[model samples]
Target: MKKTTFILPILVIAVVAALSAVFIVDEREKALVLRFGRVVAVQEQPGLAFKVPLIDEVVTYDDRILSLEVGPLEVTPEDDRRLVVDAFARYRITDLRQFREAVGASGIPGAENRLDKIMRAQTREVLGSVSSNDILSSDRAALMLRIRNGAISEASGFGIEVIDVRLKRTDLPQANLDATFARMRAEREREAADEIARGEEAAQRVRAQADRTEVELVSEAEREAEVIRGEADAERNAIFAEAYGRDPEFFEFYRSLTAYARSMQDGNSSMVLSPDSEFFNYLKSSTGGVSTR
Candidate 1:
């Protein structure tokens, strides 16, 4: 009776322990319980979980964020610019049953491989329609959104939810880089030449305007000087006419005296005169009142 009691208690305790075994799932983890190599329950909550012991196997998967970097791919844009683009993505396993069925034994590597293929194909298809400048500039965000949407949609079968997609780097081949740089340099030089030519043209226009102004000013000054000179000459002639009209006889005598003085200024000069010449009549009148010595 004592042996039966001990054995029965031991069996009851074992059965209770086996039927009442509980699992503590973390907030960031999902638990998969398999019975006899077949998944029987999926626990996604952050509490205790009961399962049949010895027959149930538990698999814990992280429900946190996961990152996968796709390998570099060569893409040609609409402008014929070839680039090696490296990209990455963030995702999480949203469906454990589907993940287990699709991933099988390969785990995350299998998921990453499948993602890489899809990413490469979608990247090529999306970027191929855009020019290189657009890809490098404003269209990048739209392109990434499209890639994320397409990846999530396609990866739905694999039980993966894509959160975001980002491009890490875009590289140009060495030969293409050299060509692009050369073209850029040529364009800059052409623009510089055009600016220089425009500046020279503007300078020429300014100089021409200045020269025209200078010519106009000089012509105006010359005209003004000629008018003043004419006015001065007319004024002098009017004064002379007024004086001469007032005393014609005295003016004639003064003019004759001025002529005689200018003519006698040369020392070796001879004069011919009549005895009753007007020049001698003045001298005779002065001598009659004074006496010749």
Candidate 2:
């Protein structure tokens, strides 16, 4: 019984020690063995790894692709236009030793923060070289590629492989949007007013033309009517003069008959005149005759 008790304790202790010395590294992880706060080995592959019991520490990092939201940043282009930029990056830890050396106790969070700085700086540099119009132009694809390349180049110092950098959104600031809208509205209003003024000018020209045409037409009609009336009076006077030359008595008698007819044209007319009045000469004589004065 005593021998069994002694062996059981020894076996239990050995089992505990063996279990602590061995660790399984998963395919999704890269592990580092640290002794007394110093890096001793890096296990980059998935398998069983061994370490000193109670004296060594193992730290694991993800080998899979990691995403980082670089967060929102602001920049001013060459034209002094302000923009709010949101970006993200895809990266993986390429050199775990270098990463651990650079960021000793800070872990992945600290490394990601550092990478964010690199991304922000490079994004600002690439976007700052051109005007804001270029950011929204067809060349924006090339511009974004340059930004990604710049971030990738700068990310190497931090022991990370930057696969790509992408902009989530690029837009004008809220203040700039309000100002731009105001300017657009003002321009539209000015254009509308100009159009109205031009329309009024055209209307005035048409009205003036109509008034002038009416005056010219009225004046021409009056001139033609006056000429026709004067010609009619001349023809009547010539016909009377020719008739008088053919016979003196006959002309006087005919004129008296016309005057008498005109004076008596109304059925209820009354006239007080002497018997020898010239108006009655035509009634007094059946023959064509006039009394001698």
Candidate 3:
């Protein structure tokens, strides 16, 4: 019973020691085993790992790609125009030992700080040489490439791999915004005025054309009507001549009747003519007679 009790206690102690000495490394993590504050082993694969129970410690770091947002950095370009530029970067730690050495106790934060500084410095260096207009231009793609290359080169020293770098936005300074907006408003007003003037000019042309067309149409119709009236009058005169040749007395009577009808056509007509007036001759003698006067 004494032996069994002693062995049971030993087994319990062994189990406790084993539990303390064993650690796990996830697939998403990389671990470092340190002995007396000195790194002794690196475990990069997933599964169970062993370490000295009391004298060793493990530190795990994310072995995946990380993201960083560098800045809304104020930059002055070649044109001496100030702009607010923001940027983002993707980075990964390629060398764990160097990363640990470079950052020490601060870990990811320290590394991020380094990346931000390098990225910002490169951004300034590349963008500062270009005009503000260039930054806003289509050549921005090339400019970003230059900045990214610079950052990648500079960050390599800290065992960091720059996967990509990009400028998020570049904006004018607040002080410049008001002036720009005012200028834009003025330009738009000028363009609108030009458009209005052109429209008015076109409208005038259309009105002039319509007036000319109306005058031409009325003049043509009047000319055609005058021609028709002249032909009808000639025909009527010929008919009267034929009637006169056929019967002189009847023609005289018809002419007298027509003259009398003209003199009395108005509903309220009044005449103060002498009876000898030629106008009254036809009325005075319906049978037709030449006026003696």
Of the candidates shown, which would achieve the greatest TM-score relative to the real structure? 3
lDDT string for model 3 (1-293, tens) is 99998999999999989999999999999998888767889898899999999889999988898899976899999999989899999888887777777787788898899899998899899999999998987658888889878988888887789988888889987778888899999999999999999999999999999999999999999999999999999999899889889878777767777776787787847879777877666567764464333
What are the runs in model 2 whose C-alpha is more than 4 Å off? 199-293
What lDDT score goes with residue 89 in model 2?
88
In TM-score terms, candidate 1 sits at 0.62
Q: Is candidate 1 or candidate 2 better by lDDT?
A: 2
Where does candidate 1 stray beyond 4 Å? 1-21, 34-41, 50-57, 65-73, 83-88, 104-106, 130-146, 163-182, 241-293
Q: How many steric overlaps are in each model, in order? A: 0, 0, 0
Best by lDDT: 2
Q: What TM-score, over all chains together, does every model reach?
A: 0.62, 0.68, 0.74
Model 2: per-residue lDDT, tens digit, 103-124? Answer: 8889789989988998889889
lDDT, each prediction: 0.85, 0.88, 0.87
Q: By TM-score, how accurate is candidate 2?
A: 0.68
Candidate 3: residue pairs that collide: none
Mark the regions of model 3 whose C-alpha exceeds 4 Å error after superposition: 3-7, 137-141, 171-182, 209-255, 270-293
